[model samples]
Target: MFDNVKNNDTQVSELVASICRLASCMEGRGDAAQREETLHETLRLTYKLEEALNQRNERIAYLDRLAMTDSLTGLLNRRGFQAELQRVLASARRFKETGILAYIDLDDFKQINDTFGHACGDEVLCHIARVMERMTRGMDYVARLGGDEFAILLVRSQWQDGERCIEKIAHEINSTTLRWQEHLLSLKASFGIQTYDHNSSTTNLISAADDAMYLTKKLKRDKCTLSAAE
Candidate 1:
């Protein structure tokens, strides 16, 4: 909204400047040669203003992209993802559609950081991000929700299909290995999925997904413990 106001101010200023220049040219009507020169100067200034406005628009667009994107993985950041989700919700309200939101957390990301510095950890995250992009459909949205957290939105998908898609994504990510220097790094993540419709809010859905992910992680831990006992 502030950007809109700023842009409007710039446009108004340009229009006023152009009007003033034309008025100055009309005021010197007695001097034909001077008026022609002023007319040409005004036309030149108008062209310059147009170019400046175009450049300003391009700059704004670039900044907007930078603001929404995660620098490390080149995926949408949390803010960007929220904006996209809200847009999806608006569409859901209008069309009575449904979608899936999955929250993912790396199981042992801190261990990797503790063992092999932050730089290696960063690279591993990037690799995982790439794997996620490869596994999902073009219509789905992928985002890095800070730290070791990521999210995917299955837009307008059937409930059963969305569940299956998320399950495949989790498996693909778990099985993938990254060769970093002398060590081969494998990452595993816990995922929680929740379906959203016109009635869903962003905060509630994310919170629910997070709870589900934690429960999934607990089940995995319990299974590991039982297997070890055997």
Candidate 2:
């Protein structure tokens, strides 16, 4: 990886060196033919320089994607999600739309790991990631915010619609099952949702949704406790 980066740097340096030599030739006192040759060289070097710069830019963009993408599930990492959230907020302000943020925490994920092992845990996360990817539109941002936690953003949506959308998503997630080896593992997640307009800040919005998710999880736990008692 470092070698590839260095090679890109070297290509850029070589193109720049060629451009500098052409500049020196144009600056020196010379005859018309010599000056014409130098001018042609400069013009050719200009295109090469532009091409080199384009390649460098492409490499930078690729690196950025690598930095922002989660390795496990191919979803956006936390940093990427926050950056995307900022963009969605800006877009909402400009277009006068509302954005929805849903924070999801997988229920009893640790126990699943303790019983079935880490490989099974990984399968569960990947399976859930696929379900989320399937459920969302291409434009929507969905990220696994590390370790049984995921976030979803719905742009240009109304509060009621966003609420309903998350309800459906939660149902889909909670009802799903992943068959790993000999066992069929039940998957469940608790979701906390918040609606944001231009007035909302990313930090506060995330915190709000996270808090809501905790509340949802607690309520679900309490309901289960009550049912067991009854």
Candidate whose TM-score is highest: 2
Candidate 1 lDDT over 98-130, as tens digits, reads 999999999899999999989999998898789
Clashing residue pairs in candidate 1 are: none
Give the 10-residue window scoring lowest on summed lDDT in candidate 1. 1-10
**Which portions of model 2 miss their true places by more than 4 Å?**
36-44
- lDDT minimum window of 10 residues, candidate 2: 1-10
Instruction: In model 1, state the lDDT of residue 212.
Output: 94
The whole-model lDDT of each prediction reads 0.88, 0.90
Q: Could you give candidate 2's per-residue lDDT for residues 67-152 as a string of tens digits?
A: 99999999999999999998888877787778799999999999999999999999999988998888888888999999999999
After aligning candidate 1 to the native by TM-score, how far in Å is the CA of 155 from where it should be?
0.8
